[model samples]
Target: MSADKPKPAGVKIVDAAKKELMNVSAIERDGNFLVVKGKIFGTMPMTAKLSPEEARKALRMLSPGLVWFLLTFPFRRSPEPPAR
Candidate 1:
């Protein structure tokens, strides 16, 4: 990809300095597993497969945070009224 090209929709890996180190190309569910495909330092390809149990654990960890975000979303912003 060209340096000026927009990156595809995916996850980004960053360090403590917030500098991007890698990019995840895709994440998909296959049967009972979750598959993640990405690149290391934008060059080396890597893939990870998560089993159903692992997926469930991930969901459990994320659910509360997700719920809190959703619950507070409406109050986080006030939409401007339409111009008269």
Candidate 2:
């Protein structure tokens, strides 16, 4: 396989990150770069591109915030329960 192609797990890891991270819910890979895209407030478009090392660093930095968001975002109630 060409080195440019990511291993299957790379896609999975990126997918999970996109799902769990705020403002970063879509992602793709371009060679060694990870391409991330999502919306702020679920409406404003945002994007980022990261090399492999940068991607790893970003994930590490985001891990705590992701955990905290997951822990707190769902149970806390809004005036109305969220639609989804």
Candidate 3:
């Protein structure tokens, strides 16, 4: 995609950096770029563009975070045990 083209929201690009890199938590839209948690257990920034559908597809492919997030976000938190 062209540099001028805007990136779709919520897409996670499993590009070379991701493959090379571990322990990443989030992939978010930043301007025209996508910011992913680095494999080094940190954060890595990628400058790429994708369509919304493409973004969603990429997100699903790369990160288990998304799947689990969607799966668990809707449910309420479990209650803690009573104090002794």
Please tell me which predicted candidate would have the highest TM-score against the true structure. Answer: 1
For each predicted model, how many residue pairs clash, with residues at least 3 apart or on different chains?
A: 0, 0, 3
Tell me which of candidates 2 and 3 scores higher on TM-score.
Answer: 2
Cα lDDT tens digits for candidate 3, 9-64? 44233444444334444566866656564334236443334556777777768567
Runs off by more than 4 Å, candidate 2: 1-25, 56-84
Write the candidate numbers in order of decreasing lDDT: 1, 2, 3
- Per-candidate Cα RMSD to the true structure, in Å, reads 9.3, 10.7, 12.1
Residue 34 in candidate 1, Cα distance off native in Å: 1.1
Mark the 10 consecutive residues where model 2 has the least summed lDDT. Answer: 8-17
Candidate 3 global lDDT: 0.55
lDDT, candidate 1, 1-84, per-residue tens: 657978578678788666778889988888887898999888889998999888678777767879799789868874565699
lDDT of 2 by residue, 1-84 (tens): 657855343212223334422455567887888788776554566777888887677667767778799789778863654487
- TM-score ranking from best to worst? 1, 2, 3
Local accuracy by lDDT, each model: 0.83, 0.63, 0.55
Backbone clash pairs for candidate 2 read: none
